[model samples]
Target: MKRCFTALIALTGAALPSASGQGHSALVQLQAHHSQADLEHMEEHAHYRYVGELLFYSSSFLVEEGGVERAATEQEVLGIDLHAHDGLRMVDQRIAVHDPLIDKHIILLSRNEFGALVLERLSPLDRDAFLANKRATMEQPSSKTQ
Candidate 1:
């Protein structure tokens, strides 16, 4: 009986992190790797034209409509909200290039899991700006006339 009790206690200790839902370090590491890859891709494509900080949070809410007697409809919605949360930081760097291809840039930073941080690429211009830029570029006269 003593040996069985001791073994149970040992097993419980080994499983405590999972049971308590605190094992997020692995997810954090994966996010870090993703951030690195994004940075590298941005550099290779000459897209380093802007640098900024960002903070984001994601949450899931159970939305219930109507009363329980009338067949309450409940659904879980995942929402991502950006905020200027405290203690959030980003390290932005641009690659060494004489002439960057892009003129404007935006960076998105967010957290994964509890404390993991990630960086994503974003375009600074709105839809109209993007369309105008595309049109202007396309309308430019080339050296060889059509």
Candidate 2:
């Protein structure tokens, strides 16, 4: 099995509203493709694409949809809504949390015929512990680094 991924950086990406109600970050588009090895295979490869966005508030970021704040599950990342096609198929998706001191990152993972980690999304973990750490950092005077 062979696979390829293409990321389309939006030239005019939409801005996400921060916790302060101001737009700060841009949403990026991502695409994943998979094809079979056998030349006899008649079916075309499968392609998936979606726009990724994250909302920052206080000291953390969360996946936002229609102004609603929530964690991005596996389904939120790779679930295709388009019409069904013939060829390889997406097998499964998973979400994992990685905690490193104050910075906790959440990773979205997907599996398909191409490979186990066909797609992934790295995002900040939204939790009280992380929020507190971020808030403290934000409140600190900038002179410390100077």
Candidate 3:
């Protein structure tokens, strides 16, 4: 894993999780990655490219289609109608939330029971907890950007 600081976005050459529905093994093995502290520092510098990766660990998404609730890849969920509320089951990220505001979704790089990287969405509460972990990890950031 490598991350380059551009004008805004960090070119984090990262991708989806493993097939086993686990977390990002690449990121975890890397010496340096885009931690929440790095993102926060970038924000202080006003670098607001795509904040989605910052929420990588946040379970910020949920998908249940055709009365079948299963974890799906981002590609599999792409381009599905989300507003269908009736017998129509669809996939979407910008689902309505209790805050009366469109909830922005993010890809959560989590791990399944097999220790493989899996892509999923974190709940709001989980997202908050992830941020807290990020805040804690930022106290001693790593510089091994290899």
| The 10-residue segment with the lowest total lDDT in model 3 | 110-119
Tens-digit lDDT track for model 2 on 63-85?
A: 44454555433233233221121
**Cα-based TM-score, every candidate:** 0.16, 0.20, 0.23
lDDT of each: 0.25, 0.26, 0.31
lDDT of 1 by residue, 1-146 (tens): 34223322322234233411211222222234347555444333322111111112111111122311111011100111122222343334211111122211212322232122211222333223434544566788453211
- Writing each residue's lDDT as its tens digit, candidate 3 over 1-146 gives 12323311221223534322222321231113456675555444322222233223212334444544444343423322222321222233233222112222322222231111111233344345545555666775763211
- Comparing 1 and 3 on lDDT, the stronger one: 3
- Estimate the Cα RMSD of every predicted model relative to the unseen true structure: 21.4, 21.0, 13.5
Using lDDT, give the best candidate's number. Answer: 3
The residue ranges of model 3 lying beyond 4 angstroms of the native Cα positions read 1-59, 77-146
The reply for model 1, stretches above 4 Å from the true place, is: 1-33, 49-146
* Cα misplacement distance, residue 90 of candidate 1 (Å): 23
TM-score of 3: 0.23
TM accuracy, model 1: 0.16
